[model samples]
Target: MRIGELARLTAVSERSLRYYEEQGLLASTRTPGGHREYPPASVDRVIRIQELFAAGLNSATIAELLPCMRDVDGGPGENATPWLEQELVAQRDKLDRAIGDLERSRQVLDEVIKAATGR
Candidate 1:
């Protein structure tokens, strides 16, 4: 499949595919006419990549953790704790903090509204 086709199928932007290639997260071959050709496996790879990115893992960490992502039992390596798991935990914590901040801001806004309305 071509890069555009993969992008369409995976719902990821073409620019992201190119960036992934540049970052070595993805590999592709060039046709004689200079078009990029992707193997079918790339579709699955892209899904996994996007899922990890959504979990708040950076590209560098994803690169290092890609091997573990493949292993069903979290691989045998020491670093195979599944960075995605740790990332998800961190993201949850960050989200909790954000929610608290938002709630505080909302309370302030409510007070301002009540004061302005003399309620």
Candidate 2:
């Protein structure tokens, strides 16, 4: 499919798809006229990229992890290694801490809201 179709299917902007290519997180070939032509599987790849980004992994980390992941089921690929596992664990820990902090802030906000409403 074309870049626009991939972007629409993944609900991502064309600019982001270009950025992903530039980041080496995605791949594509050029048409005779020089337009980008992506494989159908690119849909899955883009979704996986978005999921990793949502998990707070940077582009560099995602680039490394993508090769180690299966776009279909997200299972570990042959390239998956101990060091990559360790890095993912650290990222998960960071997300956990951020979630905890956000929860505490939400609780404080709830208390303030209750006080303001005299409830």
Candidate 3:
């Protein structure tokens, strides 16, 4: 399929798909007319990429991790390793800390709102 088809199937913008290719998170072949062509499997790949991004992984990190994942379910592939597991654990911990901080900030905001409302 073409880039536009992939974009429509994945519900991602053409610009984002191009950016994914540029970031090495996605792949495509160029046609004779210089248009981008993608394999049918790119749909699942794009979904996996979105999932990783949603999990707070950066493009570079996702690039390294992609080889270790199955496109269908984002499960570990043969290339998965203990080091990768450790890296994911660290990222999860960082997210946990950020969540805690955000919760505290929200509590403070709630208290301020309560006071301002005199209730």
Best by lDDT: 2
Comparing 1 and 3 by lDDT, which wins? 3
C-alpha lDDT score of every prediction, in listed order? 0.83, 0.91, 0.90
The digit string of per-residue lDDT tens for model 1 on 1-119 reads 99999999999999999999988889999999999999997888898899888977689977866755653333354455656567657767987888999999999999999999998
Please report how far candidate 1 places residue 105 from its true position, in Å: 1.3
* Candidate 3 lDDT over residue span 3-102, tens digit each: 9899899999999999999999899999999999999889999998999999999999999888777557555577877877888889899999999999
**Candidate 2 lDDT by residue in tens digits, 1-119:** 99999999999999999999999999999999999999998998999999999988999999988887755666657787787778889989999999999999999999999999987
Stretches of candidate 3 exceeding 4 Å from the true structure: 73-76, 113-118
Off by over 4 Å in 1: 53-65, 70-79, 82-84
How accurate locally is residue 84 in candidate 1, as Cα lDDT from 0 to 100? Answer: 56
Off by over 4 Å in 2: 74-76, 102-119
What lDDT does candidate 1 reach at residue 30? Answer: 99
User: Which residue pairs clash within candidate 2?
Assistant: none
